[model samples]
Target: MTTILVTGAAGFIGYHLSRRLLEDGHEVVGVDNLNTYYDPALKLQRLQRLTAYEGFDFHRFALEDGDRLQALMRERDIRVVVNLAAQAGVRYSLDNPRAYIDANVVGFLNVLEACRHHGVEHLIYASSSSVYGANTQMPFSTGHNVDHPVSLYAATKKSNELMAHTYSHLYGLPVTGLRFFTVYGPWGRPDMAYYLFTQAIAQRRPIKVFNHGQMKRDFTYIDDIVEGIARLLEHRPAPNTSPLTGSAAPYKVYNIGNNKPVELGRFIEVIEQRLDIPAIRDYQPMQPGDVPETYADVDELIRDVGFRPSTSIEEGLGRFIDWYTGYHQPISVAP
Candidate 1:
């Protein structure tokens, strides 16, 4: 079994991914600072589940601590490194831009450094669909130009791709970057739009419909995302020579998404149907640093991994609501 290190191990996606890896008999070393960016209680709960696995190990630290991170890599002899930790949220970046830089940029550099020195076989990190900011493409493709990022969060993700490429070129690091679409499911982040909408609707409160209900999202289920990641864990990228730089960097990027865009209004209606309650629609204009639509082109992901996210919103939301109701019985309004 491969010894893999997953950063942000207590996060929504990271927790799920780590559990999957452990189940697959891989020795997983999990790292997270348990930061207060969201509820630490939820993070702890996820960690508790992972701790039950015999193959799982946990470390309480942030990626910004380069010395400690390097030490951990050396100690564990980590082969595959999955960097999923980041300062998430596009709107939050407007007010706290520095947090994005510190975590996404500086922290990522430490991850790259650790992988470069630790004989890590493959370096897989999370990128976001937000990097396609201001691009009105129907289905966002990795080959499409992503140089015009509207928000600081997106800019940081783009910077990660560039930084990863630099390391791959110089050190022959096998780097794979995943640009995730709107991922939603049980044990998901409370700050995401889906979770917020579900909470509001359950409490008989108004749910804010952004872009006047004109926005569309490629809402990928969490299971599909984790499945794609599991497949790619062993499918490391090969060196592809670039004529511009004359460097054959073992680097690749793929979009892991549903490849189907659902309207914001309809998405809420599904939630309402599941909750058996009608939502008070508070239609709002598009927020700053927000786009009207996000659709993913998962052609490369399918071609390489022979997998595609096919979970429909109806079925995926049904499972999520089932878990949500059970987990949050007697749900209270969020502060």
Candidate 2:
């Protein structure tokens, strides 16, 4: 069994990945600062489920602590390092720029450094679809140059891809960065549009329809994301000698998303139908740092890993709502 270190193990995607790794009999070391970016209780609740597994270990810390991170890497036989931890949310990044700088920038640097020094076989980290900033490109591809980022969150993620390439070039670390679309499903981030919309619709409150509900997102499901990740974990990129290697770096990026782009209005309609409640509607112009649409071109991901995300919105949302109803408990802190 490989020993895998998953930063942000308490977060939505991290928890799911860690659980999958454990189920596959891998030893997983998970770390999270348990920051109050969202509700720490929710993060803790996710943590509870993973901690019950025998193959999992937990640490509470931030990515900026490079020294501690290196120490942990030394302490564990980490064959694979999946950096899923980050300060998430585009709108929140506009409000709290410091968090983005601290976590996404400095925090990610530490992760790169730890993996570089720790004999890590593969380092797979999260990127975002937001990096396709202002590019009117339909079906965004990772092979495209992502220099223009609209949000600080997107900028940091773009920076991450560049940083990983440098590390891969100098240290020969097999690095893969995944540009995720609007990933949603069971145990999703509360700040996400799907989760928030679900909560509002459940409470019979008005769900803000952004950009007059003209927004479209390639909403990938959690299971599909985990599957893509799991597949990549096994398929580490090989160092290339050809010019395509772009300075001999063992680094690659791919867009992991459902090819289907669902409009925000139609997405909400599905939620409303599921809950059997009409949403009080609040139509608003698109907020700052919000993109009008997102579509993923997963040709590289499919070609490289032999798998791609295909979960339908209906099946995915149904699972999310079911989890939401069962997990809700007055937002009490997990003891």
Candidate 3:
């Protein structure tokens, strides 16, 4: 029943989250620039689906436009803001560092300001597991200090956490940041490894296996992510009362990931099984801005939200393959 705003509404996670909110009877206002970071066709298709819902409203604009964003938020009387929009992809950040700053950093600041001035009740934004850069810890936890980030993308996300904390401390904003692990599902980003591998296998092309196929990821499904966000929307963070850091700011951060980590080789095997196509493996050195593993510790997420992302790679990938084959029928393998 609340009027909620979702940035990046045409992106994979944003699209799914917006649909879920609409299905739950909430008035969902979605915003996206629909940039060519990926195929605009896919983004348009996702928006097409959302347009069917009566409760869903769409706005096409970059969040970096502070004035327009402020006007939209104030006009809509946005109660909750879910910031899922950003210049994603760690490797992409290397070639295009400015995009990360413009979208992730500058754009996020606009969102924070809008929320602060608009009297928004709750603000939930996306952080990433990549923030645990260079840390060889088994399960990355929020309690662990994430001072070191290997990529510009990770650094920006960490910066977002810092910015959100500052807003909470200064303006008494109730803010929550969810550090997402490897999120994948239907209508997922084509830039992700699984999506790329699927395309390669379908074309009988050699798929690049970085670090000689040695990597691990906690692949969380889209449903689990949307479910976590839905739960958190109702459970806003209260003022911090921890004696260790006695600042009474209403801020919290949680890792929303499947505690289970799957090896890169094993992940590819699942794709091959579902596709019935043997992958031509092209083993390569580890790319820069890449990590060997990402395992999220969801203990606090479980304790606070009473939910855990339990989607297994097998099931999640199977569902993704189903959607992929159906969506991209007569699969196009253009260079």
Candidate 4:
């Protein structure tokens, strides 16, 4: 079993991925700052679940702390470093730009340094579907040019890809960036649209429909995402024979999405049905840094990993609603 370091262990994706790794008999070291971007209590709950596994180790520290990160990586003999920690949310970045620089840019740099110093075999990190910003392309592809980002959050993620490429080229680090689509599932982040939508619907509050209720998103399920990462954990990138870059670096990027985009109104319909309630619609203008739509081209991901994500919107929403009701019991969501 290989020893792995998973940054952002308490976050939605990190927590699920780490749990899957531990179940497969791998040793895992998880790190997180537990920032109050949403709720630290949920983050702590995730950590608590992970602690039940003997093979999982927890570290509560921000990734920008280079010294601490270096020490943890060096001491653990981590073979694969999955950097998942970042300041998420496109709109949140508009409110607090400094958080993006600190967590996404600087924290990522520290991770790259540690991997370089420790001779990490494979470096896997989270990139977002938002990196496809401003592109008129129907389905986003990793080979496509991602120079026009609409939001600071997207820009930072794009910057991460470029920064990771530099390390891969200069230091021969085998880096793979997985561009995640709008992922939703049980134990999901409270800040995500689906999570909030579910909450608002349950509370009989107005659910905001952005883009004048015309936007679409490639809402990926969490289980499919974790499975893709688990498979890629063994599929490290090789030196570029024909990489997106001219430099011969073992770096690559893939769009890990459901390859299906669901319109905003339809998504809300699913949530309302699950709650058996008629949602009070609140039509709002698109916020800054928000995209009109996101569609993923997972041909490359399927070809490379021999896998394709296949979860219907209804099924995924049902699972989430079940978890939501259980988590917040004694509160009736009867429509």
Candidate 5:
């Protein structure tokens, strides 16, 4: 069983990945600062479930503490590192740009440093589909140019890809970056559109339909994401010496998404159907740092890992709403 270190073990995706890893008999050392980005109670809830496993261990710390992180790596003898911890939210980053830099930039550097010194075999980190900002590219591909980023969150994610490439070039580290599209499902972040919309609809409140319901997102399910990640755990990248860059760096990026873009209005309609309650949509202009549409081109992910996310919005949302109703207490709608 491989000893895996998941940086954001308490997060929505991280928690799921850690649970899957533990089920596969891997020794998982999870680290998180348990920051109040959203709701720590939710993070704690996810963590509590993970702690029940025999091979699961938890650490309360931020990734920026390079010294402590290195110590943990050495202490745990961590063979593979999945860096998922970050200050998430595209709109939040506009005012809290420093938080993104401190966590995504400075914190990621520490992760790379720890991997470099700790003899880690593979470094797989989270990247966002937001990096394709202002591109207007249908079915965003890894080969497409992603130099333009509209949000600080997107910029930081792009920076992560660049930073990983640097380490892979200099230290021969096997680095793979997964650009996640709109990931939603059980135990999802409260700040996410899906979760927030569900809460609003359940309480008989108006759900804000951004861009006047013109938005589209490649909503990937949590299980599909975990499956993609689990499959890639052992499939490390090799050096690309194919005369493109003329350098043999073991670094690659793939878009892990459903490859199916669903309209915002249609998504809400599905939610309404499941809940048997009509939604009152507050159709508003697109907020700042928000994109109109997101579509993932998973050709590379499928070709490389032999798998891709295919969970339909109906099946995925059904499971999420079921979990939500069971886990959450009664909701009080605002008058």
Candidate 6:
């Protein structure tokens, strides 16, 4: 069985992807620091599920620790590497920029170095939809210039794409960078708007509606993200042979999004409908590093991997609430 290494295996998307890999009978080596970004308990709970599988092996450490990461990759004989470890949250980055540099930039460099020396066959890493900063264009495309990033988090992720391209060009390491849109569903991040809004509405608290409820997001579901990543694992990029781009690099980037931009008001309305309660909406001005809307163009993703995220917000959020109720137990708060 081919062994693959997944960083940030304790985080939201990482946990889901690792579990999916284990269920497919692939040997997976998971690495995570399990920091108190939100709650270590939730991360541990997710890890506990993967630990149940015989093919899953986990190590607790930050990706910035190059020595440990290299050792783990070498020892595990990892054929593929999926680097998902990063200090997420755009607002958090504004407050703590160093965290983003330490995790997303330094940590990602370590991952690249490990893949290079260890002879990894394929390297798939997470890019962000936030990288399309200041571009008001409809349905952000990968071919568009992403030189401008509004947030430190977006800048770091954009840096990752550049770093991966360097590695691919220099060492012939095949790399695929996925620009994920607003991903939401079960086992979601607490800092995310969907989860936060759900919690507030459940507690009979006023939910903050930023930008005066004028925001739009292409909320791709977690299952769809996992499916897209799974399909791209085997489809490694080959060196570009086109004359338009002179450099021959085995690197590619794809946007994995639902391609359906739902308005913020409609999204909250869906949540209210699913939970059978109305939310106390508190309108607020736009926060820093916030975008007006995000709609991804997944044409390249479909052409390359033959898969596209198609989960509607209503169906996805319904599944999330069902899981949330069961996981959190009897709801004491108002609905």
lDDT, candidate 5, 1-335, per-residue tens: 99899999999999999999999999999999999999899999999999999999999999989999999988888989999999999999988999999999999999999999988899999999999997787989888999999999999999999999999999999999999999999999999999999888988989888889998999999999999989888899989987867779998888999999999888999999988889998899989989989999999888977997989999999999998887763653333
Please state the error at residue 180 of candidate 3 in Å: 0.5
Per-residue lDDT of model 3, residues 252-293, tens digit only: 999999999999999999999998888999999999989999
The candidate that wins on lDDT is 3
Candidate 3: worst-modelled 10 consecutive residues by lDDT: 326-335
Per-candidate count of clashing residue pairs (backbone under 3 Å):
0, 0, 0, 0, 0, 0
Please give the TM-score that candidate 3 achieves against the real structure: 0.98
RMSD of candidates 1 onward, in order: 1.7, 2.7, 1.4, 1.2, 1.3, 1.0
lDDT per residue as tens, model 2, 249-325: 77778899999999888899888888777888899998888888899999988898888788999889988988887
lDDT of 1 at 144: 88
Stretches of candidate 3 above 4 Å error?
333-335
Give the Å shift of residue 93 in candidate 1.
0.6
lDDT of 1: 0.93
Candidate 5 Cα deviation (angstroms), residue 156:
0.5
Candidate 4 per-residue lDDT over residues 229-258, each given as its tens digit: 999999999888873356899998999999
Which residue pairs come into collision in candidate 6? none
Q: Please state the error at residue 55 of candidate 5 in Å.
A: 0.2
Model 2 C-alpha lDDT versus the unseen true structure: 0.88
Give me the overall lDDT of model 4: 0.92
Return the TM-score for candidate 6, rounded to 2 decimals. 0.98
Task: Tell me the spans in candidate 5 whose CA falls farther than 4 Å from its real position.
Answer: 332-335
TM-score of each: 0.97, 0.96, 0.98, 0.98, 0.98, 0.98
Clashing pairs in 1: none
- In model 1, where do residues sit more than 4 Å from their true spots? 242-247, 333-335
TM-score, candidate 1, is 0.97
